[model samples]
Target: MRIGLIGAGRIGQVHARSLAADPRVGELAVTDLSPAHASAVAGQVGGRALPTVAELLDSAPDAVVVAAPTDTHAELIIQCCARDVPVFCEKPCVTDQDAAQRLVDQVAASGVPVQVGFQRRFDPGYRRGHQDARSGVLGELRRVHLVTADPAPPPAAYVTVSGGIHRDCQIHDFDVLRWVTGREVVEVFATGANRGADHIGAAGDVDEAAALLTLDDGSIVTMQASRYNGAGYDVRMELAGTEATIAVGLDSQVPLRSVEPAPLGHPERVWSSFLDRFAAAYRAEMAAFLTMVERSDPSPCTVDDARRALLIAEAVAASRRARRPVPVGEPSSSPVGLGSS
Candidate 1:
C-alpha cells in the first residue's frame, strides 16, 4: 500500500519508521514544513519527499498519516477528505471544539474515513482495561482514576505553542476516559499548579494538574497530569466498582521497591519521553490504521471521538479559569488553545 506521511518532525519520524518497516507498505510519500527534514526522513524510509500538501495529495497514496502540529490537523483532514483520501491524523484536532466539529462534519460529508490519533486506546494494558469495563464485571462502577506524568518536560520553546497542558498532555487521559467507560463527561472541575519549573510558568502553563470529571452514568473520573516527575514517566489507572476494582500499570523505566539493584549496566528508570512509554501503542495504532484503510472500515478513533475529548478538555480549561465547576454541555468561552508541553 502506498502511504503518504505529513510532518517529518519527531512524532512524524516515528510513524514514518513504522510505515517503512511494514512489508505491506509499497511506497511512502513524505512532506513537512522543513523540506530538508522531510527529505531526510523520506530517504531513510526509502521514500520521496513532496514539497507541499497539495503535492502529497496528488501523489495518490492509499492512506495518509498526519503527525503534524495541532493547528494544522483540521485543515489537512479537510483537504484529505475532499479528495476521498483516508487520513490518520494526530490529536487535538485543531485545539478547539467548534473547528474540530466542523472538520469532522466535512469529513463525514465527504464520505472519507479519518482516524484520530489516540494511541493509548490501542495499548495492551489500556485495551484490556477497556474490554473489562465493557464486560460489565465491575458492577456499579463508581470511580475511574488515571495518573500520567512525564519524567521531564519539553523545552520552553515548545511550551510557547503547546496549546497548554489540558489540550496537549491530558488529552490522552481524556480520550481514554471515554474509550474505557463508553460514557460522556457531563461536568468538570479542575485545579493546577506551577511548582516544577520557571519556564513552565513563563510559558503561561502549569507544571501539574488534576481534574474531576462527572460521567453520564454517575461514575466519576479523576485525572492527574504532570510535566515533571523525578521517578519516571508514569501512566497508570484503576477502575473501582461496587464489585471489584481493575488496575492497569505501564512498566516504569525505573525499578520498584528493590533492595538489591542490578549488578551493572542498569538503565535509569527515566523514560526519555512519551515515545518510550507508548511506542508499542504507536505501532499498534498504525497497524490498525492500515487494516482500516485496507478494509474500508470505520476508524477506531473516530472524528466524533476526537470532538468529544477536545470539548471535555475545553470544559476542564474553562473550569480552571472560572475557578468553579463547569458543565460539559456549556461550551468553553475561552478561545485560546492549550498551554505548554
Candidate 2:
C-alpha cells in the first residue's frame, strides 16, 4: 500500500523506518514543517517529500501516517477522513476532550479507519499481561500499579505545550489500564509535586504526579508519572489479583540498587528513550495498521479509544486541581475483538 507520513521529526522518522522495512508498503511520501527535514527523511526512506500535506493527500496514498505533534492531530484526522484516506495517528488525538470527540464522530461518519497510537499495548510485556488478565489466568484482577518516568523533563517550551504530565505521559497508562482490565474508569484522584526540577514548576506543570482510579469492574489502578528520574526511561507495570501477581518492564536482576539497576536492572542500558523502549511495539503497531488498510479491518485503536483515554487524562488534571475525586464520564462500550487485552 502507498503511504504518506507527516512530521519528519524523531517520531516521524521512526515511522518512516518502520514503513520502509515493511514489505507491504509500495510507495512512500513525506512532508514536514521544514521541507528540508522532510527531504532528508524521505531520502533516507527512499520516499518522496511533498511540499504540503494537501499535496501528499492528493497523491492518493492508500493511507497516511500522522506523526505530527499533539495539537495538530484532530485537524489532520478530520482532513484525512474527508479525503477518504485512512489514518494512523500518534496518541492523545488532541488535548481538548470535546474536540477529540468531534474528530471521533467525524471519522465514524466518514467511515475512515483511524488508529490511535497506543503502541505499549503492542509491547510484549503489556500484551502478555493483558492476555493473562483477559483469559482469567490472573483470576480476578484487583489492583494495578503503573510507573512511567523519563530521564529528565523536556524543554520548558515542551512542558508548556504538553498539557502537563497526565496527557503527555500517563495517558499511555490510562489506556493500558483500561485495555488490560477490560473495565472502564469511574473516578480519578490525582496529586503532584514540583520540587527539585531543573526548571522550577517547569512552566507551571508538575514534574512528578500520581493518580488513583477506580474501575467499573471494581478494580483499582495507581499511576505514577514523572518527568525526571535521574535514570533513563522507566515504564513498568505490576498487576495483582486473587490467584497470582504479574509484572512487566521491570527486571529482577541480581544487582539491587536505587540507581536503576534493581527490580529492573539496566533498563537504562536497554532503553535510552521511549522510542527505544517500545521499538518492537511500534513496528508491530505499524504492521497492525497496515493490516487494517489491507483488509478494511476496524482500527486497532479507534478514535473512541483515543478520546476515552484523553477524558481520563482531563479528569486527572481536574482531580489534581480540586484535590478530590473527579468522576470520569461514560466509559466506552465493551470492545470485543479489537485485539485489546
Candidate 3:
C-alpha cells in the first residue's frame, strides 16, 4: 500500500525507516513543515516529498501515518478519514479531550480504520507479560509497577506545548497497565515535583511525576514518570501476581555493584538498549496493523482504545492537580472501547 507520512521529526523518521524496510508498504511519501527536513527523509527512503497535505492526499495513498505535533493530530486524522484513508496517529490522539472525542466520533461515523501509536503495546516483553496475565499464568494480577524515564530533558518549546508530562510520558505506562491487566482504571491519584536543576516547570510542565491507579478488579498500578534519566531512555515494568513476579527492564546493561563484597563474582549487569528488545515487537505491530487493514480484521489497538488511554491520563493529571483520587469511568460510562483481550 502507498503510505504517506506527515512530519519529519525523530519519531517520524523512525516510522519512515520502519515503513521503508517493510515489504507490505509499496511507496513512502513524506511531508514536513520544513522543506529541507522533508527532503532529507525522502532522500533516505528514495521517495518524493510533498509540499502540502493536499498534494499528499492527491497521491492517493491507501494509508497515512500522522506523526506531527500534538495540535495537528485531530485535524490530520479527520482529513485522512474524510478521504477514507486509514490513519496511524501518534499517541494522546489530541491534547484536548472534547476535540479528541469529536475526531474519534468522526472516524467511527466514517467507518475508517484509525490506529494510535502506543509502541509499548508492541514491545515483545510487554506482550509476553500481557499474555501471561490473561492466560492465568500470572494467577490474578495484583499489582503492576511501570517506570518510564527519558535520557534527559527536552527543550523548553517541547515542554511548553507537549501537553505536560502526563500526556507525553506517563500516558504510555497508564495505557499499558490497563491493557496488561485487562481491566479498567477506576481511580487515579498522582503527585510530582519539578525542583532544582531543571527548567521543566518554568515551561509549565513537570519533570517528574508518579501516579497510583485502582482498577475495576481492585488491582493497583503504580507508575513513575520522569524526563531526567541521565543514563538513557529507560522503560521498565514489574508485574506481580499470586504465583509469579515478572520484571522487564529495557536498559539492563547498566552495572549494579553490590554494597557488601560477598556477592557472586563482583556485581550484576543488564541490557539497557530499548530498541534491542522492542525492534521485533515494533515490526510485529506494524505488520499486524497492515494485516488487519488488508483483511478488514479489527485492529488490536483502535481509536477508542487510544481515547480510553488518554482519559486515564487526563484523570491522572486531574488527580495530581486536586491532590486526590480522581474517578475514571468505564468504557460504558464514556464513549470508549475495551476490546477483547
Candidate 4:
C-alpha cells in the first residue's frame, strides 16, 4: 500500500517512521508547510516528499494520514474522502462541536472510511479494560478514575490556541471513557486552577483541572489533568466494579512513588511525553488504519465518535466556567468559548 502523510511536525514525524517501517506500506509520500522539513522526514523514512497536498493526492496513495494542524484536519479529511481515499486523522478531528458535526455529516455522505486517532483504544491495558468491561469480568462497573498529566506545559503560544485544558488534554480521557465503558457522559461538573505558569492563566486556560462525570449507566467518573506533572507524563485509569477492579498504566515506568518504608524502587526511566508513553499504541492504531484501508472496513473510530468526545469536553469547559454541572449534548445549556487552532 502507498500512504500519503500530511504535516512533518513532531506527531507527523512519528507517523512517518511507523508507516515507513510497516511491511504493508510499499511507498510513503510526505508533505508539510515547510518543504525542507517534509524533505527531511521523507528522506529519513526512505520516501518521497511532495510540495503540496494536491501533489501528494495526485500520487494516488492508497490512504492518507492527516497529522496536520487541528484547523487543517476537517478540510484535509474532506479532500481525501472526495478523492475516495481513506484517512486516519489525529484526535479531536475538528476543534469545535459544530465543525465536528458538519464533518461527520460530510463523511457519512461520502461513504469513505476515516479513522480518528484515539490511540488509547489500541493500547494493551486499555484494550483489556474494555474487554473486561464488556465481558462482565469486572461486574457492574460503578466508578472510574482517569489521570492525564504532561511533564511540562507547551509553549505559552500553544496555550492560547489549545482550547483550554479540558478540550486539549482531557479529551483523550473523555474519548477512552466512552470507548471502554460503552457509556455516554450524561453530565459533568468540572473545575480548574492556574497553579503553574502565569502564561497559562494569562491565556485564560488552566494548568491543572479535575472533573466529575456521570455516565448514562449511572456510573461515576473522575478525571484529572495537568500540564505540570514534574514526575513524568502520567496517564492512568482505574475501573472499580462490584466484583473486581482493574488498573491501566500501572507499569514499572509509571512515575508514582509510594510513601511506605518498603516501597517499590523508583524507576530510572519514566514516560516523559505522550510519544514516549503511547509509542506502541500509536503504531498499533496506524496498523489498524492500514487494515481498514486494505479490507474496505468501516472506520473503528468515526468522526461521530470524535464529536461525542468533543461534546463531553464542551460540557467540561462549560462546567468550569459556570461553576456548576453541565449536561452533555445540550449546546444551549453550555455556551463555550472554543479556542482556535
User: CA lDDT, every prediction?
Assistant: 0.85, 0.83, 0.77, 0.90
Q: Which pairs clash inside model 4?
A: none
lDDT of 1 by residue, 1-341 (tens): 99999999999999999999888899999999999999999999899999998998998889999988877888888888878889999886787777877887888899898889899998898999898888988887899999888878888988878778888889888899899888899999998888877887886678898999999999988999988776677788899988889877635453223457644234555566678878999999999999999999988999989888888888888888777999985866665754322
Number of the top TM-score candidate: 4
Root-mean-square deviation of Cα positions for candidate 4 versus the true structure, in angstroms: 1.8
- Regions of model 1 farther than 4 Å from truth: 250-270, 337-341
**Model 1: how far is 263 from its true place, Å?**
20
TM-score of each: 0.93, 0.92, 0.89, 0.97
Span of 10 residues, lowest total lDDT, candidate 1: 250-259
From the highest lDDT down, the ranking of the candidates is 4, 1, 2, 3
lDDT of 3 by residue, 1-341 (tens): 89999999987887888888888888889999998899999999877899988899999998898889877888898999899988888876776566667877888998988888877788777888888889898787898888887766778767667777887777777778878778998898888878534557665557788988898988888898877776556678888989998876533343233467744243254334445445666666677667767787776787788778878877777767667788974222222221111
Choose 1 or 2, whichever is better by lDDT.
Answer: 1
Alpha carbon deviation, residue 181, candidate 3 (Å): 1.1
Ranking by TM-score: 4, 1, 2, 3
**Local accuracy of candidate 4 as per-residue lDDT tens digits, 55-109:** 9999999999999888789999999999999999997677778888889999999
- Judge candidate 1 at residue 27 and give its lDDT: 95
Please name the candidate that would achieve the greatest lDDT relative to the true structure. 4
Decoy 4 TM-score against native: 0.97
